[model samples]
Target: MNEDTARLSLKIERLEALLAVTKAMVTQHDLDKLLDIIAHEAANIVGAERASIFLVTSDRRALTSKIAIGMEETGLAFSIDAGIAGYVARTGEVIVSDDPYGDERFNPRIDEETGFKTFNLATVPMYGTDEKKPGPLGVFEVLNKKDGDFSEEDLEILLALSGQAAVAIENARLLAELRLAQDKLDRENTRLRQRFLKEYAFENIIGIAPAMTELLSLASRVAESTANILITGESGTGKDLLARAIHGRSPRAEGPFVALNCAALPESLLEAELFGIEKGVATGVEERDGKIAQAAGGTLFLDEIGDMSLATQSKVLRVLQEREFTRVGGSETVRVDIRVIAATNKDLKAEIEAERFREDLFYRLDVVELCLPSLRERREDIPLLAEHFLEVYRLKSEKDIKGMSQEAHDVLVSYTWPGNVRELQNEIERAVALAKPGETIGQEILSEKVRAAAPSPLRPMADAVRALETGLIARALKESEGNKAAAAKLLGLSREGLRKKMARYEIKL
Candidate 1:
């Protein structure tokens, strides 16, 4: 073959490779993967020493290098109007510099910083029809294009690549939105589950906090078994959810999961509720099975078991110990096979010490004691719970709420949610139903009680938050004497979360 023909054949082969790369890029719906693919392929297709793709920040005033290929230290960052690439991004035009040093707009500071010499550069704006101030959709730049200066054919190829990159970027954004919507739906389902649990709530037992994660795990482990279980928590937490989750996961899932607030019923009637009455038994005319019989082949959740009157307590104690109970006024014995789960917000140990709750009965029911952490302990779960409730109310109310504003997230993450998850759920639902659609539920959305407790920090908010975060981590580390795990715990952060913040703030210790 002739030399020209040989060269033409090689060019055709490279074009085919480029086409494949473009197809692969299009197939990527994730922005990060698409960016790296585009950056790598751009370098190979243009035969440049390096290629990088940058996304414009929301402020439209900075270019952040998201992907970099074959570039030392992997980036060229610039302000919106600062350098050649920045000018292209700022002006919506191609910027070509034959010699990096000679061009007025060529800022070789990145080369200086990375210790790489930039001989040539070709920067082009990826424009979109957004019609706002009209800026680059994104910016791609290459260093030292091979086979002479970047020609019209090279620009055409770059333009085609730009279109593909934009498509991938837009698709990635859409996918993110879809994922968010799906997450919202999942949270709504959780809210419905919470509602089911509410029907079974009693004596204001609070087991809704994540510290209850341990309790939940334990409950699920023993839920299907016939062993009696106890739910332990401070008063007013939702132990009902734990009971329901256990029942829902159990072998007797289809059977009734009956509940009674032992504290609320009269001692005389409590006996009637637990043991069945015959048709002619006493003044109560109806022949009905008691809670134990009603909960046959299922779970029976008893709330405030510690508060049962001594007389009634002895009867329950007998049923629990012997698997049998007689009706209040009838002599016939009723036998039931049941999974018993009991909750008491009172400190059972103290109750036992005070002799308010029977020691033997406590031990019998305490076969599995699930201690749910109060809201003060698992404060980290608050933001997650808040988001869950927000999603729920938004969907049910058919509001255009996108998500929590950064301010709302900050407030949520900071507050000590005294009322636990239930309180937070109530707050969010109220806000979603009350706030105007398409607007964030701000501090205004919160109850007056919570609003008053929030920090009255002054604004034009001092550039203090970033500095404060950094200072707190540093202080904790110093207090821990550089033990990172302890420092993270002191700051109420997980190890990974702490590491990320430390890296972000450049806090070495």
Candidate 2:
């Protein structure tokens, strides 16, 4: 071939080789492996003895070798302002050095350490797509050209290789970051699932009273079934908690547990929230799935179902009956497979008699009814629940509180918690906040209403008298600072008589 034709042939060969490098890079996702491939290809294409690709550190303070060819050890690093490679990285220029040792910009320490002689070398800057990087990503360097000193053709080849290598490096980094983020998200999701299961376990409900025990036994039995359930109780009586425990124990434990309060939204909005809305259903409203769709293959907890409007109740009834629903302003009939667990603080029977709630909807939801006892009805569980809350709040607040004083326990047990178990939980949390570190929660830290609560006059005479006597004795002890003689004097009784009464009432200081 003539000189010009030979040159054209070489150029075409180089171009084809670079195309192969690009194709190889596209398939390689591992950052370390990709860098090794790029370095090997660059050296082969340019007939170099060895090659190295250095990358800018995250802090942009230095460059470290990502792939070093013909070297037993890798990760050779130096300041970004130091060598010929640094110069190309800083200036975004290609450098061809026939005598690298003679070049002022070349650092010979690397040669001394590795015991490798460098006759000639070519360095090219690698540019990346990140605008945040103030300079080139790093430098691509090839050492000791085999035939002679590195040539202009060799520099051009290195430049093309560097460009492709830069893109490949960026893609590898992005892929690595995405995998890390996904791994972190997966760990977080697993942690949340574990926490959810622990929180809603049936044994963690904190009720041991006979009323609660019977209720829990029955609830646990029905939890495995697919029947719709209605939970009726006063507000804060743990209806929501029981529903969650049921879901966590059921066959749908792996599925979602979606909750919506029927009283929280108006009729139109509640209907849309339950059944979802179509795209362009209203101006600026995007299409979205509702709670029903979200609860597919899971459980839907409808809190305060008695408060749902009759119009919405009728739609919910259709869903329970036909196992399908249509989104508002949409014609698509969406089918669902979800267990419905509805709760209400209101008396649905009374509401039905008053012609407010639909009787048929009530019947559908009430397939299995579970009535949670009010906190007062299960007062024997108070101390256990209080201690549970104490430990929880102590850890949360990082306090050193040990337990509740007998006076505090008596007050908690005596008080009729109108807000039920939720109120007791809040009360304990409050007492914990007000209590001093290393001290027991005292009646003094309790809310004034709790401190001064007396038995209702409607209680049986003996029970009412016993509660009154207990309150008076507790107050006397508090006034006298646990001095039995002074407390008895204040209460018009001998110290021995007071001790006997204290024994009978199980009162401890």
Candidate 3:
């Protein structure tokens, strides 16, 4: 063939090859594998034996290979500025050599390592569209051009391929980083969930008020016993905290503390979650030991026991009576030595009267009983709880927020906390996290949903006591009708008790 005719045929073939590389890149965009392929393919298209892709790293001084082909089995990384590839990556341009030995860009060290002599060579920068300052996605090179030396046509093809290669490489890198970030976020969310369960309900049992003190003392006493303990309280009154605290203090503290909220899960789910199931025992073949078995020698805190379905309540009653249960899907009877600490924010006596709760189960669990007080009943404990939550949020948020000021403390002390300790804790936590650095929490820090917007401090005891004393004296006189003995009944006091209070307040009626 003549020189022009041969050259025309070669150009068509090169275009086809370039199309093949571009098609292959679309099908497979995995960075490491693609780099290896691009290195070898670029070499083949240019009529060369070996090629390497060197990428610009975070520190822009040097270019490093994501991978190298036609070298040894060992992984290799080299610089673009130090060698021909390095020089191209640093300058963001192409470097070509007709005679590698004659060119300053050629490094003899790589030739020594690969045991392959490089003759005519060319390097082009792979530029990513994602970057502001375009760094090298890779360095595309041809080791030896065929039929004497490479031409401007070969260089154009390489540059065109380099542009496509840069986008593909950048896309792959972004995808990998995105996946890594997603995995990290998922792991962190899981950790936060675990920590929430560990700390929020179980760790926080707030207040030292008389009502709370009695409840905690009873819980501690009951923790020494293996009997089924029943707890009743208002919703959000820390019933579960009492149960978990008993479990945490019990002999089973070292064992698993498997707790289930009966109100949280439906009957079918709760049953499966509580009981063991065998592999292939039903559809979706896998075996799972129930929460009862999971608790084994530990304590199983059954929260919101009133919400348990009748059928589940019957099964639970049997477990209390017989200390055994069958798995939801398996018939084998399993006996668990779990210390049952049950809690409800509902009154079982009322539930039983309403025929919603079983009498037998109530009595069985009622072997030991404790009741937590509502936050309104413990107004004096609010300041302590608020401060506690402040410290907790301060550490959790990694902030420098100081504690609530004296005015804030007084407001917390006297305001009727309708949402209870948990609400107070959340309020303080929110306030502390939102507070500016070195700022003390004020009334503004509080959630207006709690105390009305622009909340004022509580009414002083001095301002309130006069009305309180007058009401008591009037009630005493109304009930007694000038006799203290009968008035004591209406006043919920002994005659002597009534007299002492009346004298203290200096009531005249």
Best lDDT among the predictions, by candidate number:
2
Tens-digit per-residue lDDT, 252-286, candidate 3: 76576788899999888888887867788777868
Task: Please provide the root mean square deviation of candidate 1 (C-alpha atoms, Å).
Answer: 31.0
Residues 264-292, candidate 2, lDDT per residue (tens digit)? 99988998999999999889999999999
lDDT of 1 by residue, 1-509 (tens): 69889779757855775677577865655677777776776777778888877778878888878777776564556787777878788777887778879888877778778887888878877765556746677887888887788776667667767767766776777788898999998798677656655543332233355555665656667876767789878764567777777777677765678998898888878878878676776664888888989998888899888788767777888888888888867887778777788998888789878878888888888998877777668766667677777887888999998677766766665676777667778878887877887787787677677776666677553457777898899899999999999999999999999999888878884
What TM-score, over all chains together, does every model reach? Answer: 0.48, 0.74, 0.50
- Any idea what lDDT model 2 has? 0.90
TM-score of decoy 1: 0.48
lDDT of 1: 0.76
Q: Cα RMSD to native, each candidate?
A: 31.0, 11.2, 12.6
Off by over 4 Å in 2: 1-12, 70-73, 147-157, 225-228, 267-298, 310-339, 349-367, 386-416, 427-509
Model 3 poorest 10 in a row by lDDT: 448-457
Of the candidates shown, which would achieve the greatest TM-score relative to the real structure? 2
By TM-score, rank the candidates, best first. Answer: 2, 3, 1
- At residue 353, give the lDDT of candidate 2: 97
lDDT-superior candidate, 1 or 3: 3
lDDT for 353 (candidate 3): 97
